[model samples]
Target: MSPYLKLLFYLSGISFAVSFEIDYSNPDVVEYDSNSQIEKTEKVDLRVYYCSFCGGCVYFHTKQLDPTLKKIGSYIDLKNYPYGLTTRYKKHGKIYFDCAHGPAECHGNKLHACAIDILKNTTQSEFYNSCMMNSTWGGEGSSDKDAINCGKLMRIDSKPIIECANSERGDAIMEYYGIETDKVTNPKNKHMPLILLNGKEFNRAKDLMKTICQTLTKPPPECKSYF
Candidate 1:
């Protein structure tokens, strides 16, 4: 991995560790005498692979996943990757492609990637939610202005994000997402909003909340109904 990617991983790990407080007093916790062996259950990482221009992906995220995510909060670590669905075209020895949502969607993807890099955790979510909610998916036109306006509303400096979107670094990040997306085993997994729980592919988008609750080693109070 590149140094930048390494940094992103390191920062994400730190964020996950610091975001939640573990409860050792849970009733399920086994009290161990000095001679008794103890078992460890690691926290699950929930990664979302999505495309900026996919209408279903956008709707699912904003309407379904976001609310549950907020409810679950620190119970799981969340990672969002923006993958483009267009195939690259070679012309005059240069490679280019038009996104399903148009060039504006490509720009929006770059902007989202840059926001994640520039901000951490909740701030990243703030920008992402704003952009997704205001984006022009399933409709006409681009979401460039909406994304920019959202950044401004969040008090983030939009200049760096804009510059990153146009830089080689942004291209590298997008390529990384593409490489990751291609590794999925499912033939129909080329579509957006591919969700993974604990590094395992998770289908059944409608049962997302239940699936997440089931996977938790020590689910929070909000997950009681699902249990």
Candidate 2:
């Protein structure tokens, strides 16, 4: 791996050790005698993968870092932070994605855990912070009304994809948001697909959130849950 990746892994290991609290339930009572064992696992994993593959990792990295940086913190505030975390990149500025792929290159892969973590850890301040950033990434309202607006925007942005959802319940929700399934082209006249879906139509923002939620459906709850 590259040096950057290595560094990230090292930092991840140290942070994980200091940050995460181990939970050894009855099933693993005999595995180790103390939390130190758990901390060891975290360090090794961070070294081996350079990543926890958890959204909480993103939570700490983004929220605890500098605000001017490109992390979720720069765009969001601590109050908007999801449930599992403690801060929102409060001290540092934006940093790059640190994943193999860089930021501004999102293809719905690296961001899943991060976003879900934030949603779960959200506070009123973070909510308002998100709203002002663009009101698109779980910011501002996020209620049914805001969801409708987001749905409308998503539909307008992904016409063909949204239409493919045609008879899906998700599509029905999108319609309720006042976003009709149709084609839209920017000034460049390029075709734009509205709505995003893993398999079916995404009628509401929450519908799309299902995909984000999938990233956290694992053990140790790598990415904390807000809902």
**Maximum-TM-score candidate:** 1
Residue-by-residue lDDT tens digits, candidate 1, 1-227: 65334323433334432122222112121122112224333346777777676766666665556546555644556677776475455578544656777787777677677766766554244335434343423232125555554455444566777787788777666766666766763666766778787887777456777878888878778779986
Model 2 lDDT per residue over 142-186, tens place? 233333333342222223322332323332232222111122212
Cα lDDT for residue 160, candidate 2: 30
TM-score of 2: 0.16
What local lDDT score does residue 110 receive in model 2, on the 0 to 100 scale? 18
